[model samples]
Target: MQECLGFYAWQGNWERLFGASFPQTTDQAGVAPLLSRVPVVWFSFDEAGNMTTQNAYANRPKGWEKMVDACRGRGIAVDMTVAYLDGPKLEKILADDSITDRIIAGIEREVALFDGVNIDLEGLGSKSVHQADSRTLVRYNFNRFLNKLRDRLQRLNKRLYVCVHPLNGWFLGYDYREIARLSDGLVVMAYHYGPTPEPYEPVEQSVTLALASGVPQEKLILGILTLKPYEIPETLAEKVGIAQKHRIGGIALWKISFLNEDFQAVLRRLLQIK
Candidate 1:
């Protein structure tokens, strides 16, 4: 079984994944031994890696360059998240044509430093964070934003990948079919199956649903949960095997920052299992 190690660089803490294993200096060569065989995609959280509330992406973080440079030096692929908001602030920003244009321009500017872009516009249709009446507006704005992004990246001949959750009543803002058509690939966030004792959609189930959704299996990247918020007996290796047997384009572990040495070793074993 072959699997790609996905690094979610949340909170500027890539080192957290391996703890002491990460050297004090990212400058050392031949780091990330796990990446030797498979392609790695880095998922930098949008809105400054914050989860409690949506915030505008601020200035580039301090260690951004070293991380990017190190990964590229190792022949790893990288991608960052583009966050969008649907509120008074967003309305104001959109109202100003210059602001919208500048924001898009800024996105293009930032992506130049990496291999691709990952659009992570969460709270699109989630009433828990957004108003119900604004769902349609949010949906429209989200798609329009993606269209503009796709168009811009097309001009540069770059890839645009989207990471979105499974279609739920709470997040109807995203239409997977159209999204799949517009972007180079779709990363179905198969986890976050909240509260269900047995996850509503396990790894195998997510693969089945993704294939049935008209997303070319090869273009669909499975988001495997490296850290479970809840207790689940199965190990990460088991899930990797399931995904490998299904033969997805690849499986992207939800994060690098959350894995321990044991977890990473498991990841390495899984990657070489075939």
Candidate 2:
């Protein structure tokens, strides 16, 4: 099967464009080469849970439209990423039916403008809810929200993508199998295990946990961080080999802003992009 490669780009990381000589210019040509290699790109223009706001996309940075258009022009899917907001606010939002509907509707409006939506909610059960009943309630509410969102996306014919952070202390909250079944795919964040040193054990454990939780290999996209202390070419190759060996969905890099020419070339070769 063909592999799917994705890249995540944050709106705040506009230093390159803002510092460039011609900030007004769209510079589609500058990004075309990188866009050509990835099948999916998730853009975060708003803050966590900001999708519920009316002007969520109003403050989109310069060249945002041009970049999204370029991705679409190449048959690539652009997904709007929304992170989770912790605290009582998140609990209240998930528990309240009316609030949940409003949030989902707001998200749908944004999804209409993009190819899909990516939910990057993290730290599900990290809060101090000691009682077992309270924990169960929290999990139920979260799952309910996901189910409602999935159904709404299906009705709108939009893809639902979610990110599964590595199995750490925060793993108890999420039900990976349920999440996998409710969405198009899961981006398994396999990096950031420690102050990197080319460790593959974390990646392996993540994949194993995801599979054991009933997430099919085809729906699991291994995520790699491209920031400094980057993986050596050999380690990168090993990760790609692992994905290929397991017939996983594909691989995704954490951010495009940190990718350099040398690393990009390595990705192009590993991902088999022409």
Indicate which candidate wins on lDDT: 2
The TM-scores of all predictions, comma-separated, are 0.73, 0.79
Off by over 4 Å in 1: 1-5, 16-31, 35-60, 84-100, 127-140, 195-203, 231-233
Q: Supply the global lDDT for candidate 2.
A: 0.63
Superposition error at 49 for model 1 (Å)? 17
Off by over 4 Å in 2: 1-5, 11-59, 85-89, 127-134, 230-232
Instruction: Give the per-residue lDDT digits (tens) of candidate 2, residues 1-274.
Output: 2435445444433332222333332443233344422322333222233353224222344556665665566666777776654535566667887777777777877778776777766555553553566766767887898899999888888887787666643444567888888888888878767756448877877888888889988888777776667576667777777787778887776665666556666666866654
Compose the digit string of candidate 1's lDDT tens values, residues 95-184: 454555666676676667767777665545665666656766665665676788789999887777787766543455666767888887
Per-model C-alpha lDDT, please?
A: 0.58, 0.63
Residue 213, model 2, lDDT: 82
- The lowest-lDDT stretch of 10 consecutive residues in candidate 1 is 44-53
